[model samples]
Target: MTVAIVGAGAAGAAIAYALRDADADVTVFEKSRGVCGRAATRRKEGCRYDYGANYVKDDDERVTRLLTEELDTNGLVEVEEPVWTFDSAGEISPGRDSDERKWTYEDGITQLAKRLFAATDATVQRETRVETVAREEGRWSLADAADTVLGSFDTVVLTPPAPQTAELLAAMAWDDDRRVAAHDAVAAVDYASVFTAVLHYPFTLDRSWYALIDTDGEHPVGWLAREELKPGHVPEGESLLVAQMGHDWSGDRIDDDRDQVLREAVGHVAELLDDDRFAAPDWTDRQGWRYALPDGGVTGDAHRSTEDAGLYFAGDWVAGEARVHAALRNGFAVGERIVEARNAKTY
Candidate 1:
């Protein structure tokens, strides 16, 4: 079986990793230059920051087991650090104030996908934007912007967020009630936009573990982190903060003036943290995530799933969505379903 996976993030990588040992031929296609999709990282000047998922968690049992096994072979460590949760009220919930949080990786979280992608013929196409996926003959057609053909494969496993997936599927004219339902699920997969400001500070923060604030504050940065603790991602002593701004605020602003967004973010964060002397760092960068998390997360109905079948889909939005662990489990389950379907077809 030759399988083509779209959107090479946690979902894509995990499926590839699970199927790499199989006899089937797998090709992982990524539109971006590097894998990691939302779990992405960026480097500028002399500072490094995690622009996407700042951390990989073992929140679920299966995810814990999978990561634990992978950690044995890969260079992942366990940090007992705690993470704080805050609200728009400017009130504070000091996380890991007494201890550290659980974390892994010697490099950035993207390393996990890189490791998975390295073993098989599943090459990731960076800087390659997928124009459309049209069914041609018995196989599938993947096209680029010029309407040129990229490749033909027996199956396609897509892992893009709901909205993007819907657009792609609609372009293919692959309209089934189920398919349309999958597209609708993306809209129902309620999420908010986020603006993350990554700055390198000379000193550490008030909390070693980032704080989640809530106190009638307009700025609700989901949570704050020291950045130093997120192994292999940031420097040893420098400070980095990613503020998950309110969706309404982030949506209206990020598309217009990014620098203005940054300045305003820094100023708002300073107020929430109760620090007047807080000044912007010499080096600063920003990132925006539109489909950050949903209100109810992924469930069987909320996320699309097909066992080892054609035209499958999975992401953080499936079965316990938004969490790193849930995403991993979705990948594992989808891969198994695919493998099973292939076996059945062979028999």
Candidate 2:
């Protein structure tokens, strides 16, 4: 069967890879230039910025095994920075003292998706946005923005956010009940918006990540990551700091003057260290994720389609929380369901 995976992230890639050796053909459609949806990366000048997920960790042994390849323990660093929290009252330090492990992309977060995408025969079409989808004669017809007929397939698997999936299905009125039900399920979670600033410095901070003071600043900054500590992320004697602006500030200043955002970020870092000598980055930019991450991820109903057989829907959003493991778990569930449906049909 020709199965279409509507994303190239962890869940989509996992589905494709699982079905690769199975009795099915997989075709993955990615809206971006490459995989790594939330775990994305950007290249600017000579440096690569991990604006999305900085790291991933899992207690699941199988997943840990899958992601731990091609790198060593030295490739992943333990975050020892004592996180300091500040409110209008005063300050609080919730330190991390356990053996907590946060895994980063030895190169950048994009490597995770790249590795997964490479495992399957799935055709990843970048910059190809699905404009519409419809069902005809038990097959799915998907069209792109240019009015080109993308072709028909037996199964359509969507791995984008629940809201986005619902929007397309709603716009097409494809499955009114399923669409409405999907929205109800998706509305359960709130997504936080984050803005990051990548700063290149002349020296390293000797720490993999730094805990910044999250005070009452207009989009108070979260952790300040020294990217140089991540293997292959930076050169010697150079530092890369990634600062995260809180959701409230990001929402308020979503369209604020670009200069204002950068300046505010730099100032926050300066205040955190009480230093003026720390040079502002020679490069600065920002990105907005409409559904950057779920305030909480809740499992929605993942079952047979209301209109067609063998069709399935899965995504990280189902987990009611955001993380690499959540995507992996969701993909596994999707695979299990597909197998069950296929087996039932054969009987």
Candidate 3:
């Protein structure tokens, strides 16, 4: 069987890794140059920090095994500090979550996808944006922006966000009811906006916890994490902070001027941290995510619409959770389902 996967993010990469030993030809297409999507990292001035997802939690044993045993490339390390929470008033307190170990790579979180892809024989084509998918004679073919046919496959898995997937399916010329239903169901997936700012200082910052979260939902800043706490992320005598704006604030200023946003974000961070020096970082960077987190997962009725057609969907939202672990779980389940379907076709 030949398989083609769109979006080489966590879910897509995990699916490809699972099928590495299976007797199938797999090809992955990624629109961006990097992998792991929102679980992204940035490197600057000898500092490597995660600007998107801070770290991965070991909430699922399967994911834990994959990180520690299966995909272990000597870069997986545990975070020793606890995550603290605070309100808009800057009153810090202990977090309510379990004492599970937090995980990250010495290089970056994107290493997870890189390692997974490396373990597979799949051909990953970067910078390939699949515009539409058409089904013909029980096979699926992908087309790019210029209407060029990428490839035809026995199975196609989509791992992009729900809205993007809906757009792709809606563009198909086929008149199958399953396609229309999938488009409608996926189109309804809602997401939250997030604006992140990465700041670097030449001096050291002494903080007890690795990160702080605004639990009351009343602060302009939703989260603030010290990237230097992660080993090898920051050079000695230097500090890096990743500050994320709240949903309302992010949505309001997402399109604002970059300088204006950065100035306001630094001010907000300074006030939140009770340090005037935070207002003036040695270097700074920013990113705005329109679909940072999914509000809710698509209903199962919608998921069932494409199952019989050998069209599978996997992502953090597919499992009704906005965590890295959920995406891995969804990928594993979808890969297994696809393998089963392929075997049935051979018989």
> In order, what lDDT does every prediction score?
0.69, 0.67, 0.87
- Stretches of model 1 off by over 4 angstroms after superposition: 71-74, 95-101, 175-178, 206-208, 213-218, 231-237, 297-309
lDDT of 1 at 169: 66
**Which residue runs of candidate 3 sit more than 4 Å off their true CA positions?**
none
User: What is the descending lDDT order?
Assistant: 3, 1, 2
Estimate the overall C-alpha local distance difference test score of candidate 1. 0.69
For candidate 2, lDDT tens digit of each residue in 1-347?
Answer: 77888888878877776676667777888888878788877776566657777676665565676666522433444444443455433343454334546666656777777777687677888888887778777678888888787878877887787667766666652555665565566555566767777777776575323454455544366556666656666777876777777778776676777667878878877666556745466666666666777776645453333424545766667655587767876786787667666656641
Which tens-of-lDDT digit does each residue in 1-347 have in candidate 1?
88888889888888887787777788777887888688876766555556667667656676666666653446675545566556566766654344323554666667667766776567677777787987666567888889888888777887887667767766774544655565566555566677887766677775644445343335545455566666655666667766666666777776868888888878777776788645567667787777666556443453344222277777786654676666778888888878877877861
- Candidate 3 local lDDT, residue 169: 80
Best of the two (1, 3) by lDDT: 3
Candidate 3 residue-wise lDDT, 41-111, digit = tens = 98989999999888888999999999988886597877788789999788888874467988889998988
Candidate whose TM-score is highest: 3
Cα lDDT, model 2, residue 158: 74
Clash-forming residue pairs, model 2: 296-320, 297-319, 297-320, 297-321, 298-320
